[model samples]
Target: MKIVKAEDFDLRREVEYGSPEQNEAVREIVAQVKQQGDAALLKYTEQFDRVHLTAGQLRVTEEELAAAYQQVEPSFVEAIAAAAANIRAFHSRQKRNSWMDLQPDGSLLGQIIRPLKRVGVYVPGGKAAYPSSVLMNVIPAQVAGVPEIVMVTPPSTGGTEGIDPYILVAAAEAGVSEIYRVGGAQAIAALAYGTESMAPVDKICGPGNIYVALAKREVYGVVDIDSIAGPSEIAVLADDSADPAYVAADLLSQAEHDEMASAILVTPSPAFAEACRAEVQRQLGELPRRGIAEASVRDYGAIILVDSVVEGIDVINRLAPEHFELIVEEPMAYLGLIENAGAIFLGPYSSEPVGDYFAGPNHIIPTNGTARFSSPVDVDDFIKKSSLIYYSKESLLSNGATIMELARREGLEGHARAIEIRLRKEGKAGEAE
Candidate 1:
């Protein structure tokens, strides 16, 4: 990894960045799905997923799920259960309750929270089967009280199967209703604009390939999306006290995710920078995905030696990494300074994997540079809030004129008349004036 002084690092170049071809490809897939619907879905599935799924066999049955349990080891099943429980427990805290406040004049204002009637979660089964993603996406929706949760994954080929048994186990633990043998952009399209076998979802959540990202972008207006996620990333703002080994390992955790992923180390120590660089080389050899990790670190990774802790923090806030690790003497001291970041990991022991699996925080986070304003997937992603208001005659008359004036100022006569008509019907017309 190349080490540079913090002043030389360019964040604007990172922000104004995206390939035109990617945008064009995504737009085309989205249009094709919107027009052809199920036909388009099946065609893409056969082409990309290597599965010739008939419309009738899209949904995974109980027998298929049972067979999955037989295929996977008991230990893996137990782990999924454990992770599911942790994810469920943590997200339960995010559950929102409806509340209405009534004043003396009988005016009520509050929010009514309700889960989406049905939701679709896309789990990637191409490069790898992510059972943890199953837990993160489903548990939050379940906690939010979504009635029907549909999961979609590519069917396996070469004597392989659909979603991994561990993924099925996690889904069972999370109370997901249906699983579909579908994948890629086509699956996203099916979820967005219901196919013959699939019901359209109010919202779609989870992670997938570049094609999936493009599909989500295409169907965003038709269905709500959590985010248009990018590649994984991590930024560690450390001091001299931070351990080089831990820093290198955590960086590699996100780096191995893809060649596009970025891992950055910001510290005030030259010695620490040198040590981390050496540690990364040592650890990269041991990782199963070393080639991917190496390519990612080589292309996107950086080790910045800042002049001061404040400068280090400025770099962090500017880049807005998805995973922010505070490997400093006083991690909390800089906590408030960190205004951006999908998830914050404090202290040396708080590794990135902790949040990825057991930490109870959602692993599906805003990636690339989106953490500057975006957030991680949460229970709120599955729920919609409606503003509820009730106004008595007295309350309406008192507030009506002010509302009318504001509406009329904006040239919205209809809005003003709507309130005026209500007052006129109550036999209290022009009372406010």
Candidate 2:
């Protein structure tokens, strides 16, 4: 990994999200899915994933779901269940209900919080299958009280009959039954615009490759989507008191995710920075995904040296990494200083994977410096709010002239007229006009 001073670090690499060709391809795929429906879905599935299936076969059958249990170890089942419980517990705390505020004027003002009717969750089946993601995506929607959650994944090659059994088992454990064997931009398009077999949903969530991210960007208005996540990234802010081995291991965890995945370390101690640099090299040699991690660390990873831990925090906020590990001596002392970060792991024991796998926080986070304004997947993603107003006759009569004056000042006669007509009916015509 490259070592750089905080003053001279170049961040241009983090800003460029995807290529134009990839964006254009996603646009074409989304258009085809919208225009041709299942016909388009079938063609793209065959072309991209090397699997051919009819419209009837797109939806996974109950028999397929039942058999998935036999393929995995008993322990896998137990682990997913425990993780689901933790996730449910954490997100349930975030669940909200409709609320109303009564006024002295006998008018009612409130907001109605209702779950979305349906949502489509995209699970990437490339490089590796993420069963944990099924739990992360589905549980929040369930907690938000969404009735229907549809999952989509790419079918693998080598005559694989259906979606990965691990994903199936995770979905089942999370209480989701509707899943489709399709993925990429085509799947996102199918979810946005209903086909003959699959109904369109109100929102789409989950993380995917550049194609999937670009597809979500295109379909924002057609269907609400979770934030456009870029590559996976983790930033570690540590000091001399932190362990070098722990820092290196945690950095490599994110590096192995993808070639574009960034793993960075920011520290105030120059001696500790060198120690971590050496440890990362030693650890990188033993990783199974060495090539990918090496490339990621070599290309995107960095060890930034700052004059003080306070300055390091400044650098961290500017990056706004998806996963931030604070391995300093007093983690909580600097807690509120961290204004940006999707999820923060405090101390060496609270590693990045702790949050990713089992700690109850949603693992799907905003990447590519989007944490400055975006957030991780949560119950809010699967719900919508409607403002409620009940204006009584007396309230309108009391405020009609003020409303008309405000509307007239804005040069909106039609708006004033609506209030004028109502005020006249309420015997306040003199005050309305």
Candidate 3:
């Protein structure tokens, strides 16, 4: 880890937009899926995943879902069930109902909140195959009352029954059964444009590789997407009272995600900063993903020495990290000072993984300083809001002239006429009464 002054360190990381070859390849793949449908999906599955499959084999069978249970342990099932419950409970609070407000003029105005007709969730396979992510993506859509939640993963994740059984088990526990045995940009196009095997979805959510991210960006307007997620990030603001070992372990948890992941520490105490730097190096050697974590720490990780905790908070706000931990002596007192963070974990025990796995908050958060404006995956991602307006004749007569004036000011003659004709028909042509 590198040590630098707060003023000297730059936290802005360049966003990965994929290489030109990768982008062109994704465009070609998306075009093929749009034109060929299921045939393109199967072809890409064989090309990318090296797994040959017929159109009939593209969808996972009930037997596969049932068999997935046998491969996973009883303990895993129990734990997933418990985690699902917490996720449901947390997201259920976020569920909203359609509302209409009645006015004195007999007009009705409000929003009609409705769940999407269908949704597609892409789960990564192989090394990135996290069962917790299955819960994170699927459960919220379910809570939002989305009628159809479809999942897609590669056919084989170097596992004997094709897809990872643990992922299948997680999907089953999350109450999702419409899973397809396809992956990559082709699957994204299939979800967006519809195929013989799968219908088009209203929205797509989940995390994937560079190709997947590019595909999501390609199909964004056709079907709403959660976000163009970037590398994982974590920042810790601690003091001398905080445990250096605990802070180091928390930082590594995110750094181990990949070589692009970032982990940083901001503290006013020079002694605490040195101790954490040493502790991170010590703990990095013990991680199973040491090669990846070591690279992340060496390239993106840093410790900034601030003049005071207030200055540290200012730096954190500017960074707007994906995950933030406050480990000062009085964590609660400083909570109000945090302006930007995807997820804030205060005190020592509220580790980042707690929110990632079991603490009920969605781990799919904004990254690359996007927390300044965006938010994590939630029920709102699975639902759409339509504005409801029911104007009474009296209300229209009262406001039609103002509406026409604004429309004409914008030089939209048709819009003004649309309101003027209505007013004229009602015998108030000159001006709204």
Maximum-TM-score candidate:
2
Candidate 1 achieves a global lDDT of: 0.85
lDDT of 3: 0.92
Alpha-carbon local distance difference test for all models? 0.85, 0.91, 0.92
Q: Which residue runs of candidate 1 sit more than 4 Å off their true CA positions?
A: 13-37, 157-161, 421-433
Q: Which stretches of candidate 3 lie over 4 Å from their true place?
A: 157-161, 429-433
The true-versus-predicted C-alpha distance at residue 51 of model 2, in Å, is 1.1
Relative to the true structure, candidate 2 reaches a TM of: 0.98
Comparing 1 with 3 on lDDT, the higher-scoring candidate is: 3
The positional error of residue 353 in candidate 1, measured at the CA in angstroms, is: 0.4
* All candidates: TM-score: 0.93, 0.98, 0.97
The best candidate by lDDT is: 3
Candidate 3 local Cα displacement, residue 32, angstroms = 1.0
For residues 1-433, could you state the per-residue lDDT of candidate 2 as single tens digits?
A: 8889998997545455579899889999998899999999999888888888899999998888999999999999999999999999999999998999989999999999999999999999998899999999999999999999999988876556478899999999998889899999999999999898899999999888889988989999989988888779999999999999999999999999999899999999889999999999999989999999999999899999999888999999999999999999989999989998999999889999889999899999988888999999999998999999998888899999999899999999999999999988878778976
lDDT measured at residue 210 in model 1 versus the true structure, 0 to 100: 78
Worst 10 residues of 2 by lDDT: 10-19
